[model samples]
Target: MSTDVVQIETRESRLEHLPISFFASVMGLSGLALAWQKGVHVLYIASEWVSLVIAAAAALVFLTLLGLYGAKVALHPSHVVGEYRHPVKLHFFPAVSISLLLLSILALNMWPAMAMPLFAVGASLHLVLMLLVLNSWFNHDHFQTVHLNPAWFIPAVGNVLVPLSGLALGYVELSWFFFAIGIMFWIVLFTIIINRVLFHNPLPERLAPTLFILIAPPAVGFLSYVRLAGNVDAAAHILYYFALFMTLFLITQVPRLMRAAFFLSWWAYSFPLAAVTIASLTMYEKISGTAFFVISAVLLGIVTTVVTALVVRTLVAIGRGRSACPNRPARDPGRLETQ
Candidate 1:
């Protein structure tokens, strides 16, 4: 009876502490699926089956997360509401919708029947989540520049992602609507984040990985705009080249980033690398450049390695019970600002 009691408590604890950021794993896995799907079409080296398997895995993870998070809401309404109001965690609620969006893209090719519904639900939910997060920022008396990080870009990235499948599904006006939101906010957040990073105290180890997220908006925007406008014109050039430069710039910081203690935030590395990989493949397809092909192949290899490591580490953390260790502090330190 005591053993049963202990197990029940442990399970409840796990549910209570389950981070909204876990949806990022779905984002990473889904991005990997899409990148591989694009790779097979562009590189012609891998079987599409590889991507299909990844997409299935992503779908399973998303469903599992959805179920678990639903359970959390039911069993631990206080914790769920707490996360909803959290300064940093508030930005993550959209991750649920973003996961749905990414899965929609993945399913578009594999299970056409599932695509539109997922897109519709995901797109609608993300808009609501984004507005809520923005409202919190606008009205809050507590938010500070210290709370700013690349993860703040999460909502904006989801907006840009809308156009990829949205355009192909013939939502031209809707796609542009999303693309504009993504672009406008990307520029705004980029400026704010740059200022925060340049003169401020360095982001603590946990959030350092989110710096990789800076690569995603432009990389995804490039792909979306190219598809929407039907050409790799000057605007596409600006987006793609900016993404490529950010990729190059962050690669130089890999050594420092690698030294950070493992956190769920490390999954941040996966999706951005995957975004750049798909963007590179798209560039090669459009421009017929061997250099772009080489970049895509290299990035494909790197993202695959990074995501595989993250999965293993995460599983290992769960097995060791550190994934939600009660003593662990997932929250960032308070009051950090410019030097």
Candidate 2:
């Protein structure tokens, strides 16, 4: 073949070994599903169909990426190990586990037969992954305040995500176990992250969107707590208010976020926004008001727009040979610089 064809073939090979960060798309899509499902109840609209479509898309993306990542593990095991060992990339591993949990939640109402087993698998995997990630945090020696960011919340926050579906699946005891783990470490990590931000250099611009992740634990925790506790008690109120406060605080930072250069990390913003949207809808259910409905509707719109934009950008980047792969040099001349 000619040089052009050879290079195109080579690029395709590398793209197949995409970074673990790609799973953020799954998280975003799952969030969309949850947001819309909640919107359906509050708005009295046919939004559940939208949620189902997004959920199906998320599952397809999850399976496709899983297959690709599996291939990479089989062919380039060292690369996978290297990612797990890297401090920044390691935090994203929970994206996979969390995505599975979110998918299980979607399935819970839509596909009950599959939901129970999916929740079991998702919950089991999340717990095991949380332990492994925490162990890595303790063992890894590259300790510095600058290394802390909201991405660190994933593993710990993911534990709380389990009961969003697990409770419906009759895994009440197991859900509580994971929720306790998630909330406890969420507190520990929340303090550490706050200290790191206040004392150290700011996180790099590429990770700016990850700051949104700080909103997710409390938001998701509120939803999970309500599910497990079966009421909107004082504790649930505290979680809800904190999440609302964080959501407002983060909203003020959107200008800064917009100014930052885009990267795959921008996908970090999608799921958290969706989490808060769900939380808002949950609150709407508890306290009926036009204001609550308005808040939920607006947040849902913002999340849907963001995820859709990111998906389009990713497809464009892929077509242009600009989707950066961790394991190989980007082939297109302007690829690395743009995103």
Candidate 3:
């Protein structure tokens, strides 16, 4: 092939390999933004602007990914369909709607006008994605026990996130509907995931970081429940404490997580920690407990550190043209980064 023709194909190919899972970065960043927002109030931090800047960055990243993925859809329909069929990556697709939901929350206090539209669109889109995902799983031909991972928690857990903003948007009944679906799915999937972990082979390194996703459904569920229910009660305690327990459980795996190879999935760590941090801050706000304040402070600091590390590592990976980076190496144009 001519050099110009070869170069053109390589560029197009790079765009095609951009995975839908990159939206997890937006979820992580927006979670950090909300955590910082809560920290300022609960922890008496002076750095509220940190939240603004991170929220803006999250929005920017979301737009960029939207445009890029939109291009991939237009130029690479087959590749998109392949991802839609893939057992694992299929779940990550909902991250787009969830990111929108989170960005809606980030915009809530600062821009209520913007927040409403974002929430409306996010809520509507998430329902569609959730249905599609369920249908796929129910009718799938190729799924098996080994295909199960914590990432499967994304779609269901994402529903529990609605009330965090949906309540404020005056969608009281709708918010409850989403929350119920999310909780039911969470219970079902939580059992299946636990069973898989106990009886099946251990998750490979690439999927290990996804264990962090276990923290999000409960943490986000706690935050959403308090907003919807107007106070922390017995049920709230169950969600919050279970999430906290899961967080601690995962901490013991820190040594192994630290040793695992870098994957796009590492972004998995950011949002759950952020979820728990925001939950802690909320708990402190409601009860005036010094312990909740301390816990929130600790979690906020850890999530900030984790996000910073992820950003630096992502930049380095992109520069070196590694797996899952946007600037994928031309030599491997056909490789899907999400793998």
Candidate 4:
């Protein structure tokens, strides 16, 4: 009995070490809220109340995780630093900033007064975080063949997210600037990722879900471009079509994704799926047709189901004391890394 008790204590202790990357849950939840909000306008079955409820839930989760993570930082500053220096896990920091930006966008129609301040804070923080991550990329020689994965998109794609609400909040010029940064880096990163995949081995199974992140930039870029341009022009069509093509292309990898062992990293799939769903809904709005509507509906359902499953699984893992901090001991800090 004493041995069993000690084992339980050890398991419980692991919970205290939960990594900052858990903020990925906030990103997933906020994405779900935003997707539901878009669904309210595009689908007859969706309602404003449902969207508001989901948004509220997401806000609560975000606050709760933020507080928990803050506590972890206070108690284990070294662990936090370890995560920051980690090749793969370092990319997840932007998920916190992006989740904040997403929450601000979700609040725009629900509470405009609150939305502006939230957007201001989120946008400023996102820019700073993006710059910091970019600086690390340039100055830090952490690049490694093993570190190349889709999570690298988090910092780059986060810039595109700014313009989603920035345009609506009257920061048109700044939004365009951020949009340009996001798009330019996305192309550069895409080339690097593809080249890595062709020349190097595939990403480890645990990180395969992050491959879904490849879909987010084009989809989000399409939505942001349409909002900024204020129309479905030729350029908008190009973005939309590219997003559609990427989504279709990535769908082929679903079997490989599912075959991998489940981990918190799987949450990487959630926001990207939500992004493409929102993009589809945006297209349906602009090009009113049965086909677009059907596509939007299908993608929304898939994203909602996937995110829900991931949330449930994560909660269960936490309850069972199986979901511990993701940071492992640091290797050579100067290796070129991408996650």
TM-score winner: 1
Q: What are the per-residue Cα lDDT tens digits for candidate 3 across 294-324?
A: 8989998999999998888777766765546
Q: Report the C-alpha lDDT of model 1 over 5-41, residue by residue, as the tens digit.
A: 9999888888888888889999999999999999999
Q: What is the TM-score of each candidate against the true structure?
A: 0.95, 0.93, 0.95, 0.91
Worst lDDT 10-window in candidate 2: 330-339
Candidate 4, residues 1-339: lDDT per residue as tens digits? 699999866644564566666778788878888888889877867578887887888889889878878876877688778787877878888888888889889888987787888888888888888888878788887678788787889888888988888888889899998999999999999999999888999887667778888888888888888888888899888877887787888889888778755677788788888888888898888888998898989998998899888877777665555535543322322211122
Residue runs of model 2 more than 4 Å from their true location after superposition: 1-17, 326-339
Error of 2 at 250 (Å): 1.3
Q: Candidate 4, after superposition: displacement of residue 70 in Å?
A: 1.0
Which of the two, 1 or 2, has more lDDT? Answer: 1
What's the C-alpha lDDT at position 178 in model 2? 90
Write down the worst ten-residue block by lDDT for model 1: 330-339
The per-candidate count of clashes, in order, stands at: 0, 0, 0, 11
What tens-digit string does per-residue lDDT give for candidate 2 at 21-115?
88888999999888888888877777578888999999999999888888878877887887788787888888888888888888888887888
